[model samples]
Target: MSPGASPWVLASPDVREETAMHDHRRIGRELDLFDTDPLIGAGLPYWLPDGGAVRHALEEYIRTAERRAGYRHVYSPVLGKRELYEISGHWSHYSDDMFPPMDVGGEQVVLRPSLCPHHALIYRSRSHSYRELPLRMAELGGMYRSELSGVLGGLTRVRAIQLNDAHIFCTLDQVTDEAHAALEMIGRAYEALGIAPSRHRLSLPGPGGKYVAAPGMWERATALLTDVLDRSGLPYEAAEGEAAFYGPKIDIQVADGAGRESTLSTVQIDFHQPEQFDLHYIGADGVKHRPVMVHRSIIGSVERAVAHLIEAHGGAFPAWLAPVQVAVLPVSDAESEHAEAFARRCREQDLRAEVAEAERGSLGARIRQARLVPYQAVIGPKEAVDGEVALRLRDGRRPDPLPVGEALARIGVLVSSHSTALWDDGDGA
Candidate 1:
């Protein structure tokens, strides 16, 4: 067996079954969501169609949310010059976690470990006034870190990560409000995904000089975040030395179905990067001033979020987020054409639907397999002739038959609104 292969694969059937039920790796394989290949190197995953769909949906959801919250999305390159990191202080303190620099045309460049530095450069690309004070720049950018091989797990600890990263540039006076806004966004995102944040951590600097900001700056920034959390009536514990190399931050910890807490969202108050990049904006007095940088992410990493979602929902995704939201299963070969037509109709309504062809299994077996989908539309002769479908929900609830048009309308509403509920009873199905 491969060194990384699961030992459960060699165990008894019962043992394997019990353990594999909650294993994201096994569930990902069974659902054909993603895969890793030795030839492609460890810690790098290739998203299959199903996994790609889930990631795409998540990206769209976050982009829309950020946009509505006044965030402007931007694309930045993954690789940067060595001088860039040196100026940003990443080379001095964070180089150990970053990949080795490559010599390209006698100049050293490396993959970015985070998107904050790139966004800082973008902010400096333009001259702005205080009117643009709360400038929110967002990106769903990919990053690479030199994580240890032993620490790399399925999606949770991959070397490559696509971050839902953003930075808010504002005056020091606006720090508290921006941080509060970030927290509100985080809460909305978690509620939409049906994941509850267990606790919050006000990560502060330690006694050492590992942090880039001066002691006074660190204290001020930490105080600002603390006041924001307190005023918002949030309960959070202070964790000394848990601050990032650059600044203090608020970490939102969420628990998965397995009850393991992971930090998936964060809001960091950065006072050092602006100094490193010399980022500035003109105030109403017509003088240059440095803007405080608020680094935040609602969903820190898309890969890890999907991994958590897989376990949180036991591979049964919500209707809007599921790769294949509906499966049309025909009762027999005679109803195959109708099933295909019904699936196509669902597709026309913007639903991810597929027809489960009855080729190698009985109707009962096919229905059982189709039940894995969030919604299953069974097409028998009578239902097919009447243009109606018997809906079997993933939760084992069988709603009454409804016309195909009405069913498609209800599904559209469920998807468009991003509802976590299986299906609404108001549909009168």
Candidate 2:
């Protein structure tokens, strides 16, 4: 096997029969990661305990990364007045994919299909100087899509989405630098998450498509994104009619186990929204100037991102991302207290550790049950007496036993550093 590749593979056979299984859907069910019910209806799935844990880890990771990149996080409502969508151009150009509007005491409010309009309102709420340009705002916000019943399946194509959305308001001259920085952030995030984007496409508005009438605006935005892709030295293609109705964008695509490609992350440059919302900042000359809206998502949506991670890693998540990083198992009831204490210690250290129920069956059975866990700590009579742990990795490697503290420290380092290796024992760390 390739170095550090997981052995606990989830079955991802392609659809051939009516009962054929998809990778994440099958494993998610078996592991209780997520579920679907007739009551909740199709296209809307609720995450079980394990799935919620995984999503929490991913959300925390994204928030930290965004904060480090100088993005200020915000909370925005999921519903917006119909006029907001109109000003953002979603109503005129892309209303088909949006949910119907609702009348609340005479005001028509719609479930926001996107977060840009509200963010634009936030920017317009206050005046800014040129020095405050390139203001980065981010949110892990919920949005809805009016997807057809035939198209909805699993976490990938869902009606409701928790998007990792961000918009950078910057001066025109800073567009290239901002776009470059956004792509770099995406690269670092993808590397840490083990996502290999299949391709990068420059999505442009094609003929006979609804788009902003400003040809100059389209030209500038596409050229700027093209330059960003050029300087990054990444291969990309141009796809017609794939750009947002407002402007052009860079779409990072990923393929599923079935060989179907879908957009994973995106970096879009829009010059139209500033004018539509009349958003501006004061220049050094004390004159008002328009700011560019650079929209990008490190991981487009929590659902789609998790779906890809499940497929990519085959449900054997890395230590940091695993729902349960370590499973503590005792050989018999004698070591139950010791095992529970060890698990508690792990929890105190911010590590996700759980003691497997002994009565569930034999040691072999419990081990098989937690086969996807990154690390397993087995405490037998000798281990309990000596305060040591028999460390077994999910990859089927068993090393010599070590003191409880030392074993915990090793796993702590791996999880905190997001290292894919089972244990870093040297300078390789």
Candidate 3:
């Protein structure tokens, strides 16, 4: 049987159902988004063309947002020397979660588990004055970890993850304001995606020896975060012992359609790492002082974010983000030229459109297949002669036949505006 015909390919009910909606894993396969192969590795997934399209769209969106927010995006190596993690204290604290190092010419190198240490090195590469404080460096970096085989699921948990990661080097006095700004950016992202604003979680270090910072620094950082939350007018719940070994963080928890909540974004204040890395900037008094490091992930991981979007929207993506926005289906071989021409016009207008040839299937079968697409433009004898297309929305609404130019214009508006509505007709059906 084909991969799509296999029932075992679908995720368990617990993995993706809230009502009768489709499972993300099933939709992923049906839509040709991504797939896993046991021969390569258990947790690794290869993204198909459709999946790659969605990811590209998402990455562009976030990169634009970060640029507007004054972040300087950069690229770094995926693997680093063992001594690099040792300087960042990850070797001592997070060694269990990291992949074992490989020997290379008498040196040990490992895949980076996080982008923090590399970012620290970037900050320390140049001397900075007080005026250059709050340097925001961002990267959509790939990381590898030794995840348990049993815990790996589609996109949510994996051994190899791509992080939407960044670090900010700022003075101590700028902590509260920077945290507040991070929260505001997260709010804007969730709002754009049409996801409900998730509740805030202020995670603090517990009495366990897992925490690495001095007791005094932990208290100050935790108190500063609490103040930031209070001043931002955002309600939050504080949790003890949930903080990372190096810092206290605020986690944004979002729920999927199945009511399963996961941390999708975070802002952390780290006093320990800067001290360990000896990151410094010249103060106004002509003295050197340690810079406070702020770690943040607006959407966390690209893979996980795409998975959440798949489940949250049931794969009916917004017009701007849809892999294939419109399918042009010709009723018969006679209309195939008209259909192809119409598709070409739509593509020229910057719309994602494709022509479904009539040679492979009947009109009815073609329509059934096009149902997976957001919009279908049918060109029959009447439509071909009249220079119009019968627009059939996936939501089952059949609007009146529209002129080819008019239909393309309207779709261009919707795509440019990123409207969530299937149609911009007065009724918004």
- Residue-wise lDDT of candidate 2 within 1-429, one digit each (tens)? 221233234435433321234478887888788989989888999999999999999999999999988999999999999999998899998899999999899999999999999999999999999999889999999999999999898898999999999999999899899899989988988888877888888899988758988999999999999999999999998888788999999999887765567888999999999999999999999999999999999999999999989888878988899999999999988889999999999999999999996887999999999999999999999999898999999999897999999999988987777677887667663
Clashing pairs in 3: none
Residue pair clashes in candidate 2: none
Ordered by TM-score, highest first, the candidates read: 2, 1, 3
The TM-score, computed over Cα atoms with residue i paired to residue i, of candidate 1 is 0.93
Best candidate (score: TM-score): 2
Query: What residue runs in model 2 are displaced by over 4 Å at the alpha carbon?
Result: 1-22, 427-429
Q: Across residues 246-282, which tens digit of lDDT does each residue of candidate 3 receive?
A: 9899988776654556789999999988988899999
Model 3, runs deviating above 4 Å = 1-21, 426-429
lDDT of 1 by residue, 157-202 (tens): 8999999999999998999999999999998888788777778988
TM-score per candidate? 0.93, 0.94, 0.89
C-alpha local distance difference test of each model: 0.87, 0.89, 0.85
lDDT of 1: 0.87
Candidates ranked by lDDT: 2, 1, 3
